[model samples]
Target: MTGRGADQRTPALLLAAVLLVGVNLRGAIAAVSPVLPEVRADLGLSPSSVSLVTTLPVLCFAAAAPAAAWFGRRVGARPGISWALLLLAVATVARVLGGPAVLLAGTVAIGLAMTVGNVLLPPVVKAGFGAAAGRVTGLYTAALAAGAALTAALTAPIAGLWGWRVGLAGWALLALAAAVLWRSAAGTADPTGPAPVTPAAAGRGPATGPSVWPHPVAWAVGLLLALQTMLYYAVTTWLPTLLVDRLEAGLPTGAAAASLFQLVGILGALLVPALIGRRRGQVGLGLVVGAGWVVLFAGLLAWPAGWGLWVTVGGLAQGAGVALSFTVIVLRAHDADAARRVSGMAQLVGYGIGATGPLLVGGLYGATGGWAVPLATLAGIGVLYAAVASVAGRPVTVGGPPSVRDGGSAPVGPAPAGGRPATPPGGR
Candidate 1:
């Protein structure tokens, strides 16, 4: 292919690879969760064992995230992800052997594979699309959601038709297919661009040396990601129960409300990021979205009527928050490797912090014997997130910020997940 033609074709290829990666990463996580009860019963697992099965992957995400950059740096991003998917497929399929040992080992391997993919995929996206970061990330994030939703929605039914093992391992076929397609399309890595440098070779360490952790902007993005993620997961965990128990809604009413929240949330997430595009400064949008969630909570608490409206708006803000968190990871870093490093820190600390949300909310509910205090506390988090979003909204690179504080420069942050800024493709 001619040079121009190769450039033209690469985005389509990258998008396919990215979308497939998205599908595979979350499928392994989501697929198992829905069938977990069946797996628990079949294995005769105790409650503690079941809880461990559920919690191990999340803990792995926190513990294994930093290694992702190290692994990606040594092997190159494309190879790292390709291999991770391969491992994910093998490990997921291994569960078909049917034993606790295999299940635990397979789950651990799946978590590792997903951690690598989660950390590295953004850098790959940035390297391939450059200016189209927002569009690519929006789509990628959306696909990740789709994968989870697809598996969660279907895994139970599939298990009912066949068996729990099939349901759990069936998604591995998607992973294997993705691995094969990615290998064929990439073919010893794309010829269109040179293999990117490793972080060590490229001196991707923060200016302070030893670590980028010292940088305030990095912390800003990391904290923003953590808080937003915490909120999303917490709401997801408790929303249905809150509807059914607190509001005295029927089981179907609660389930329907939760489904609406997810659907509207996904749509809103995809649409809201476009509004921010290239121009920076998301403080206004951040505050608006954050406060919107608070109002939704208050409205739900007060009247518990017109819930569909509040739920939709809350879901919109939730999706946008998560999407924008990923966008921040891309926008705050200067290059692909740097992006990976920043992603590592954000996800490591962010996910660890995020894992607390569900437990905390649940504990509070038990302690108070009422949703009032728990819901109010969640609303408080929304306002706190808005305040932090103002800081993260400032248009500054994480490790290479113009200064620690932007020197009173006009702040920047919002970018709708739609059109990407038109930077040169080779900018990274």
Candidate 2:
């Protein structure tokens, strides 16, 4: 075949892998939330325990992200993700075994496994489809939202029919399929270099050398990503509960509404980034979206049951904000490698911070016996997002090519996940 034919086939194959992996990203996480009450009853979990059940996965996903580079280095990104899915499959089965301790443990393990996919997928997009990062990310992110929506809508009924244990275990089938597809792509190896070695001091040392980490623009991107994730996951994890418990919406209606929120988000995720990819300064656009969130939450507090459609619109705005934020990792980073590292750092700190949203909202509701305080807190976050959005939306490259930050002509830290030299594709 001609070189062009080979080149054309590569993207098609990679995109297939991306969609497969994306489908599994949230199937396990979403499966649990819809069936939480059933699982709680079956396991004899208290109300507090049920809450913890949902919280562990978010926490574990965040905690596991920082270590992705290390794991990717050790096992290779494709292999690592495959292993992660395999492990998640095991955890899914374990969760079906009918014990609180085992269920919680398995849930955490599944979340931990997911972190590998979350961290590496962006870098994979950058390295494989560098010129079209925006478009590719949109497809992948949309698939992720679809997976969440599917599980959210189907899990409860499936559980009712076959028991929650079987319902939960059913997700493992998707993961296993993803693992097989991932293994298929392993044969078409891209050239990645060796892993970087950091000394004990390296971990404790400055996050970036004074030259890179202190870049104001980098900080802006990090904060932007942090707020976007905070809001997205907060809504995904809590909105159904908010509707059911706070608004007195019936359970089925609550789940259906939240599913609509995700469906709207999937549309936003695919549409927004395409518009922004060709633009330079996106701050103003971000502010508009942030303001939309203000309206969404404020209306939620004032009119919960009657405002599901409005809240769903708000979710679209929030989804646009997140897609913009994620796209910035590539636009702002100097090159593919910088994009990878920045993606890691942004997700690491951002998700760690983001995981607090649901817990905080839940805690506030518990402490005050009302949604007022939590709504106030969420609004406060929206205000902060507006302020940060203006700065992060600007187009500025940090750690340029050949610079340590950009992952350019030189080795940034370690080699790539393929265990080769610390050089880009063909360079020495």
Candidate 3:
């Protein structure tokens, strides 16, 4: 009876740790946009260079993905995640301590740490929750959006009260908290921890079976993720500045708008599990999300004053888009190991493509001296996103034949040898 109670308590604690860690992953990055103006003034950064504050982290997400996966395999997921959180706390503090060079360096460190969390968390969810992976993933994503929203809304006010340095560094406390929680949870029990790699398995390397690289469905999924990631970061990075410049709004007003853009995403993230339950096909959801993006950019271009409606719509779409993309990743893989491999590849592809978004938007704005061209560029990306999502959202598995449809319920292959039965993807 005592053992049963302890077993039950462990998963609850693990879930809590996962949520706390999710909260830290994005808040530090999101803290930048609200105080961008102040950071620019203090650091003497140009418009294009300032965009790097957001862009560099995403670039690191791509650059560090392989290493993160390797690290997870070498050290179990719990310890890897705990270490990443500690590094996140250090990086968050380090970025605030020095000039532009230190700031960018610290940003790189933060990104590298976050990549581990981003890559490992899904497998942990799948292993820990089993049939409830979809719902838990929605919660995880909601936590992510909530953290971003809180930081976005609070940073401006905090900066107004204290300096931007203090406002930005304050988020490190959350990282520290998450680290402690994760360590506590891991100490209790870690069902999701990596299996000990025997000498034979170690010699075979981190991945076995057919590689996800040759798979077209994997590429399509990566493309969908790329578009979603690009749109989310680009908008988050520049929305406040765009509002301030185009509407001649105050910084606080602009920050409030940015906060709305992030806050409403929580609704969108939560909606995904419900949508997955009702909808047979993901193509329609993808199309609708794509349409929302198009409408958001077009609305912004046509009527800058009606920013509230456009931002709300855009925020929901961004949140759903990301959650849906990850859901597909989990649904398509045969097992947790495959999920991690596909995740590594997909994120590498997705974020590598995505990292270009903020940089390009900033450069276009700098070159053209207006938001019109940049907004149109994003809308065009939306069109392409819709087309790609149609393919990516199909009810198919990663390594399976393209014609096979699992109805979005499970992976294609047989259960991994000597492991637990392959769990259904997402919902029951």
Candidate 4:
């Protein structure tokens, strides 16, 4: 039927929109990093104040995640993402509209909009492509990394030619474009747009239920997600600044270095999933990633004066770690529904928890007048990651239909098993 054909195309279109939105997520924040001094000087900001501006969007991401997930289920992913894009576009322009205070306020909108996509995406994938969860998640996440990379690479140059305001406003156009695609593909009403919805489980509503929070599985996934996001945002927010201040790379080099770090991550993010997907040792892989994080943080702490190579190595390792972390989210959840739940839990708690990294790192740096303590903290977190990943990385499946796991929740709690339907904590 015509309807069925349109339905099939819907997921692909939504995916396209997701990719576009992902591209814009980092533009505002990453673009500002290389030019922090310029902005700070112009805005009369202290290091701590600048750091707050640098880190606020990520913090907002954590704060807004739960609300995003609830809104997605209550409204729909397509509708939610579409509206988010619209608001984000508006906010992107707003970032350029006024002084530091106004820009900071607008960043909140950007952060909130980004969270909507973060939480809803897993469920959207699960809802649309039930059987191909792994590949689909991999593809989607890779696209997200690609978006980050593109923005990271372009922001500084764009800002160089035009003022930061123009650079910031450009991203709004991309957000608008995504909004249009999302609308066309998803339709105007029912925001989820034609994705299949099964009957709600006994005493469970998709948006609000015992499933949303305070669940064991949710806690585990949330921890992992938070660890991943914390590291990623820390890098994004601080790397360029570090390169400029510590590595003596200067502004342009700092921006390029930061972008390169993320670029390496794009490769790792895409490749690690394929290599590890078939392995039965996800927990072990996580341990390895955690070890990598430890090494990364150690390198950062011990990085010699003018030793950009060490910094580069640190960035690559961190990128790989983050990519692996994301891969685990897909691997850990058994079905799309379970992935949705897991993604929601991880994002809600993970990002919320992760936001602490930036604030704490910035705060510590402010207190200490150096980066040593923050680097130490990052290493400490890495150690925790190793231990946790060791437990979480084992080859396991959970939450499928009755036929898959004999009608019980699987290892991570039932997607490849009995469909326990978890929500992504970050609001996915």
Question: What TM-score against the true fold does each predicted structure earn?
Answer: 0.86, 0.83, 0.83, 0.78
lDDT tens digits, residues 138-178, model 3?
A: 77888888888788778889889999999999899999999
lDDT of 4 by residue, 1-428 (tens): 23334346656676676566666666656666656766777778777778777677777766666566566665666567777888888998987788888878887888888878776666655555544444556555666667766665676688889977777678777888888876676555542343234454311344222343433434555687678777767766676777666767677876676666677666656656575646545666667667767776677677645335655555555655655555556666665445545665677577778877666777888999888888888888878877777755655544444564453335543243556544322123
- lDDT by residue (234-291, candidate 1, tens digit) is 8777888888886788878887887777777667667655766745666676787788
Q: Write the per-residue lDDT of candidate 2 for residues 148-197, one digit (tens) a residue.
A: 87887788888889988888898888888888776665433433432455
Candidate lDDT values, in order: 0.73, 0.69, 0.78, 0.64
Sorted by lDDT (best first), the order is 3, 1, 2, 4
What is the alpha-carbon lDDT of model 2 when measured against the actual structure?
0.69
Model 3 misplacement above 4 A = 1-9, 37-49, 156-162, 188-206, 238-254, 279-281, 362-373, 399-428
Clashes, model 2: 4
Model 3 residue pairs with clashes: none
Model 1 / residue 130 / CA error / Å: 1.1
Q: How many Å off is the CA of 190 in candidate 4?
A: 6.3
157, model 3: CA deviation in Å? Answer: 4.2
